[model samples]
Every structure is written in structure tokens, then in C-alpha cells.
Target chain A: MHFHVEVRNLCKDYPGKRALIDVSFGVERGEIFALIGPNGAGKTTLLRILDLLDEPSSGTVLFRGAEVDYSIKDRKDLRRGIGMVFQRTVLFNMSTFDNVAYGLKVRGMSEREIREGVKAALELVRLQGFEGRNALALSGGEAQRVALAQALAIEPELLLLDEPTANLDPRNASIIEEVLSRVNREGKTTIIMSTHNVFQAENLAHRIALLNEGKIERIGAFQDIFERPHRFLSEFARLENVFSGFSKATPEGTSIIDVGNGLHIEAAFERSGSVIVHIPPEDIILSTRPIVSSARNTLEGLVVQISDLGSIVKLKVRSNRDFTAQITKRSFNDMKIGLNSKVFLAFKASSVKMI
Target chain B: MESPFIEEVLSITLLSLRVSGLAVLIGALAGVPIGTILGFKRFRGKRTLMRLMDVALRSFVNTLMGLPPVVVGLVVYLLLSSSGPLGPLRLLYTPTAMILTQLIMVTPIIIGVTMSAVGGVEESIREKALSLGASNWQATWMVLREARMGLLTAIIVAFGAAISEVGGIMMAGGNIRWFTRTLTTAIVTEVELGNFALAISLGIILLTMAFAINLLLTIMQLRGVRG
Candidate 1:
């Protein structure tokens, strides 16, 4: 797909900090593009410039082959077509209905059109009976949804969400993600969201761009960036996608063993006795007892702690070796596991892949 | 000893009301816009303008607050005399002279209070208005609407100052009975004539007028708080 945005050599300077430096990228039309970076990585600054809230110090931002100029005489008309949801929920202190209808009023729409548009947009966000309620009375999640509803009411050509799920709970986060997907599919509005949550970007974004030091370090499809990340970028990215280490060496020949821990299990793959062991956390399993099972590896351990995470439960088990296991809540309930429960873990030999 | 001086005091009090009320009306119209502009707009000389206003108003108010009524009368005698530059206006010994001096005396107070009120509007509110695509002028009016209660307080304060003052009116109005003799001037003249009963009655009326102005101001401030 051809790009809807063509940013060339964008630069911005503020006092002692260079907010953006020769940044260049093009976002394909209709793609859910996520700009991911750490704090102070200029993500907000760049988004503000793109939204025309702030003027860039230099460079060109071509939206559909035209440069954006916030200082132009016709800038208000330009801003009317672009929708922005700030990180903080900027709902009016008025009724929920007024918050959604404000954009239409500013755009000079008729009263009938405003009423219909606000109703339709509110229904789209599933906030149908909330028009009469005060926006300040809403919960954080509801407030954010109202902000989304306000933006969607404009029927914008492009949507800019600044850390939309930054402070939401997991359930609310999922709801926002679902709402974004629905809008993108139904409206075909081009979206550019900035976030620090890599997992959210991985899951929702069609393309992810890694921003570092006010520059674009890598840009590609979600899995492509995750699987074959740049050497410099992967070092930091791998911190969140942790992997266990394993290796082995024996007399017959050299061989690498994928042990479930960072210990060298004696195996037939490596020559002369020196090696290491590696394990990925997802491969581990937990049980309440020793079972006569066909799996080669079965570790006996006491459950150190049980943590409940809505859909998944994490069991920190300390066997002769310490390891972690993730299982479903139903499985946890079936085993009736509690604090400090003795358990056996099983995984196939093939589950342990040599690195 | 308490003769029926109520009717005499009422007329004098009404005279004071007409002159001071007119002065306050003029002061409010001139002062509010100046204060609003100073409060919201940034210019190269804004701090200097604010400081100048501060020094000039404070000095004038303090000087007027202490000046003896007879001394002001003598000064007006000189200003409206044949040699004074304003003598051509023939405003000497007239109610217009009293109103003009009182207008000048109360304008700074109104302006100063209004400046502080406009300054108190939250910056976040202004930024939100700008982001909403309101022109700067529209945003300014919105901020003024938010600060209207405080500005109203300033106007009331100026009115109170005009009504309670005796020095400027006595000097310029010449305490002309039935024409320019306001409440404070009448009380002073009654006291000079050894009619303690009538003088005390006029004093009571002056006190009541001041109390009423203050009461209205208090009520307005309370409403502002509730809002």
C-alpha cells in the first residue's frame, strides 16, 4: 500500500534538547502504525507537531502530498479534519453529550446533524445511555471512552492517540484496543498511536517503529521487528522478551542442550565436558505431584507463590532449580493450588530446543 | 433636642448618592478594560506599566485618605480661581467638580482590583480554549466571564469609596445646600453649627449607606463562591 504520510528530514529543537532529529518515515495508508519509545524519546513532541498543535523547527510533514502549516490562515479547517485524543482524558466538565458534540459545534454543523452525529458516535463506543450524565462523574475507563467518542464524532480522516492505554487497567486496555480495531475497520481512518507498551504495539499495530534518541532506529512489520530485530535494538527489546540460556559439551562430540534452566545438562551434543543450558519460560509446566508421564523432564518443586492475573496464573516454583510456569486459572483451580504447594512439572524433550 | 432633621438628611444623602454614583459609573467604564488588557496581554513594558500603576494609585489614595477637608476646599478655591488653568471651565463650586475629582480618586482602585481578578484565571483553562480553536479574543472574553464576579467586586469597592469620601466633594462642591451638599459634607456642616442632634442623625444615615453598600458586596462575593 502507498503511504498516506511522508515525513522528510523532520527536526525540532527546544532549548537544550533536540526533540526530533532528521526523522524520516512514511506510514502506509490504512495501517495501524505504532510509534514506540521510552520516556523523553520525543514521542509526544513528534505527535504534537504532526497534529499541528506545535510547529516544527524544520523539515516537512506531507499529509497526502501537502505540507502541514499550523500558522496558515486555513489552519482551523485543517485541524477540523484531524482528530486527537490527548493522553490525559480531556473531557469537558459538562454532560457526556456536550463533550462529543463540541467538535461538531465548532465545525459549524447544524443542530440536527450534531444531535444525530453525537448519538451515532456515542453508540459506536457503546456509551448509549450516558449522554445526560456529567463527564466528571465517570470512572477513568469511562472517561477515556468518552474522549474516544468525542474524537470519533468528528469523522476525522486521521486519528492520533497519545498513549491511549497508558493508565488503563487490563480489562479497560483490552476494551480500548477492541474499540480502536472496530473504528479502524469500520471507518478506515488512518491511525498513528504512540505508546511505550511493546506488547500492545505488537498485538495491535500493523507496523511498529522503534524510536531511540529522537531518531527512528527500526521500522517493519510487528513480528519481523520482534523476530529479527536490529542488533542494537534487539539488545534492549530482548529485555522484555526474555529467554533462558542453556548449552552442553561431551566427549562423543559437541552438542548444545536446551535445559530448562541456566545450567549445563550433560548431553551427547558437545565434545569434552563444558557446556551451558538454556530455557524459555513458556516451555515450563507445573503440577501438584509426580505423575507417571512419558515426558523426559519432570521437576519436583514447592510453589513459592501463586499470582492470579485474570486469564493466566503465574506459579513461582523452587525445585532443586528455580523456574516459572504460566497456566490457566481453570487449571489452577482444578489442582486447588495454594501458597507453598508441592508440585511436579513436565515438558517434552522436544520442548527444549537447543540454541 | 431631636428636631425632625430626617428630611434634611435624606435630601443631602440623595445628593451624595447622585454625585458618587455617577462617578462610579464613569470609573467602571474606564477602569475595567484597562485592567483586563493589562492582566492578560504581555508586552515589552507590562511590568513597568503595572509598577507605575501601583505606585501612582497607592500614593494618590494614601494622600487623599489623609488630606483635611478644609485643605481640599482651599485647594479647589485656588484651582477654580481666575488664575487657574481650569478656571475657564467655570466648574468651581459646582457638583461637576466634585464628581470629577471623585472619579479620578476611585478609578485606580477599580483597575487594580480588576487586574488581580483577571490574573487569577487558570492558565489551563486558557490553553484549553485555544486548543478548541477559539480566537484569542474569544478566549479572552471567556476568561473574563470566568472572572466576572471578581470584577464586580472591584466595581462595588470603587462605588463604596466614592460614597464614603468627604474631602473631594466638600472642596469642589462648596457644600452648596440643596444642590451639592452630600451626606458627609452635610454632617460636617451640621456639627460646625452646634446642632449635635441633627449632626448625629446625618452621621447615622451615612453609616447606613456604607453598611448597605458593604452588605451588597458581601452578598455578591458569596454568590461568586457558590458558583
Candidate 2:
């Protein structure tokens, strides 16, 4: 498969700080590739470099197997094929129609064509009847949609979105995500978006690259990365029930880990010796009382802290080692669990995976 | 009712408006583009050498902004006086010489204010324009459009300065009655002759014209802001 863009050995340094260090990645043609990491992970920096809005301190960005020439004429020509939606929606101080028409006008499109293209693009984002409104007067969500329509009106070959829904409400975020997916599917536009939201990446991207501290820690399909994550990836993705312990093989072909403080976690994996273990937050069950169940590992712990994460409650339990478990708010109310409550955490052996 | 004094005031006022209006028109024609270019374009050594040049240029223009009109009159008088460098053309003590003096005074104001106005446009707007596939010229045009209010203010201010100035036009125009006598020079002539009533009447007319011009520009400015 021909790669749409190949970024090789990219490095960006700003005064006393390095934003991107030896970052290298290839974007497949017509695929939704996501750069996932926390804030200040150099996501914006990388996207800026890809968009040719910025030049890297040292690197070569190959567009369709051709190294980009960093000349004024060449860069302008290259930028014409790429559309970027900034983390902040930047709309021209004009009517929505004019903002959407700006790119086409710059490209020297005829007025009739500009009108048709803008109408279609606005319709794609479900922003019809908004053309006459001032772009600056719209709500945050509507403004963002207009920005997206502006980019799409150009019909660029590559779309680079830098946290398009960063400050948006859930409904607006979902709308943007749906539009992105539809654009990719219908227009076959190559997409590369940088997002701090892990769930959004998992939902939208066909492939994901986990970036941390200016480096790509791992890149793979969402299921594959989640199933067998690196230590840093698991931490960044908030698959946070991670532990380090020595493992010994059991007679049943399973391995038992002697976690510190007299805690033993059994896993179905065959790994032995020193290993990093990850337990998905949803896989662990929090109970008010010990239950006699078929699940292999059951540990007794005190609920040291409970954090309300919107629809769910994240409980930090202090067993032999600290373990974080996520439970529905309704479940928390039903179980009547709170701070300092003694609880039993149960998970099957297969739920514990070694990284 | 049809007094010669009133006729004299009308001619003086019309000549003053004509000279100053032409001066501002020419100044804006020359200054706005130069100011816009200086405001937006970045070149090598812009942070150091170009910045130093920018400071020097602004200092020069600002110094000229406050230039005493008599000193400008002296310079123009020497240049256009008979037996001077431009003596053969004999532009001295004429309406053309007065227009030239006022033009010199007004150009710096136009350039300084326009440069500041164009510079005040947000850098991000230019970047966004460029990212949207606009050429350098196109981006610049957009910035200028965004800064229209400041440009208009520059023109208004420069015109005001030109219309009210007396010393430069007095020396260059020679204040010949019925020919080169503008409102300002005429008021000076009347005051020197102890014609306080005529002087006061011309003063009122001058003040009214200034107010009328400012009121019109202010209305346009407010409309632009509302839009």
C-alpha cells in the first residue's frame, strides 16, 4: 500500500525545550490515523510540521514518496492539498458563506463552483441555513462546524485536525467524529487527527499511535494495543491497574505473580520471571462483601479514595498494592461504597494480562 | 447681505480646503502602500537589523509628525525661491508651493499611523489566510481590509493637520489676498492689520469646516465598527 505521508526522524526544538524527538510515522492512504496522547505530547507540533505551517528543526517529510522542498512556492503548492482544523477554531471575521468560500477563492475557483462546494460542505457538517450568519456570532459548536466546513470546502486530499473537539461538548464532539468518519468513507480523504481522548481514538481511528514525551511509544490497531499494551501506553491510556512482580508458572499452564505485600495475582498468560501486569479497570469487580465466585483472584482492600468521573466512579483501592476500579454511578449507589469502605475486588485469571 | 467681507471669507475657506484636501489625497496615495508593506513583510535579519531600521524609520516619521510648520516653510521657501535649486520652475509663493508644504507635513502622519494600524492586525489572521492557500499578496490585502478603520483615522488626522497649519503655507504662499490667501493665512493677515472682527469670523468658519470634516469621518468610522 502506498503511504500518503512519511515523516522521518522528525525533531523540533523550541528555545530550551524539545517538542518532537526523533518522531517517525507513516500515514496510510485514505485511513483515519490518530495520534493519541495527553496534553503537551507534541501532537500539535507534529501536526503543524505535517501541515507545513511549521518546519521541523531536523527532519524530512515525504509527501507521496517525494521529499518536500522547503521553498515559498513549493510550500504554498503543497499546502493547497492539505486542510488543517486548528485546536482553536479560526474563522475569518465574515459571514459563514464567505469563510467557507475563502479557500476556494484562494484556489481561484469560479463563483458558481464556490457556492456549490460551500453548500455541499456545510450540508455534510449538517450546518445548512447557516451561510448568512456571521461566523463570529455562532455558538462554539456551530463555529467549529463552520470551520470544518471551510476546510472541507477546499476538498483537500489530506485533512489534518489538531484536537478538533478539544473544548467541545460531548454532542458536538460526536457530531465532529461522525462527520470525520463519513468524510473519510465517502470522500476517501486521508485523515490524521491528534486527540487526547483515548475513547475517541478507539472509536474513530483505524490505527492509533500512542505518543508520550515527544516520542511514539507504540502504534497499532486499537484492539491489539489495548490487549497487549506497553507499560507507558497502559499508563497513558488510563488502563491504570498496572503492577510489577515476579511470576511463576502454575501446574495448570497459568502463571502466578507474587505482588508485594502478600498479594498474588494469577494470570492466564505463560510469562514467567519479572513481568509487568495490566488489569483493565472494567474487568475488576468491586463488591461490599466477599463473594464466593469462580473467578480466580480475589483481594480484600480498603477504598482509600473515590473520584466521580462524570457517569462513572473511579475507586482507588488499597490492597497489597493500589488498584483502580471503575464502576457505574448507579452501581456505586446500590453498593453504598464510599471512602474507607472495606471492599473485595475480584477478577478472573484471564483478565490479568502481562505487558 | 452680499458683503465683500463674506465673499473674501468664502474664497479663503475654499482655497484652504482645496490645498489641504489635495495634500492628504497625495499623501495617502504614497503612504498607505509603503506603510502596509513595512508593517507585514518579514525578511532576513528582521529580528535585528530590520528591527533597528524599523525603529529608526518610525523615529524619523514621528519627528516629522511634530515638525514645526515654519521650519518646513523655510525649507520649501529655499528650495522653490528664485536663484534656488528649483528656482527655474518658480513654484514659490503659490498655491502649488503651499500644497507641497502641506503634503510634506501630512505624508509622515499618514505613513506612521498606517504602519501602526497594519501592524496591529493579529498575526494569526495572516497565518490562517496563508494556510487557506492565499498567496502573500492576498494575505496582505486581507490584513489591509481588516485595518481599514485605522487607515481612515490616519487620513482624517493628516487632513486636519494640513488644513489648520498656518506657518508653512504663509511663508510658501506669501499670503497674497484674493489669490493665495487661505483661511489660516487670511486670519493671520487680518489680525496683523487689527481687523479683529474679520479675523474672528474667519476663525469660526475654519472651526466649522474642521468640525464638519471630523463629524463625517466619525460617522463613517462608527458605521464601520458596527458592521
First chain TM-score for all predictions = 0.76, 0.74
Error of 1 at A12 (Å): 0.6
Off by over 4 Å in 1: A132-138, A228-355, B1-124, B139-227
Best TM-score among the predictions, by candidate number: 2
Which pairs clash in the backbone of model 2?
none
Candidate 2 error regions (>4 Å): A12-19, A38-40, A56-58, A212-214, A228-355, B3-7, B41-50
lDDT over C-alpha atoms for residue B153 of model 1: 86
Query: What do the candidate models score in CA lDDT, each in turn?
Result: 0.72, 0.86
> lDDT by residue for model 2 over B184-216, one digit each (tens)?
998888899999988898899999999999999
lDDT of 2 by residue, A198-261 (tens): 6667768999998888998888899987877777766665557888889999889999998788
Model 1, residue A192: displacement in angstroms?
1.8
Which candidate number maximizes lDDT? Answer: 2
**Candidate 1 lDDT:** 0.72
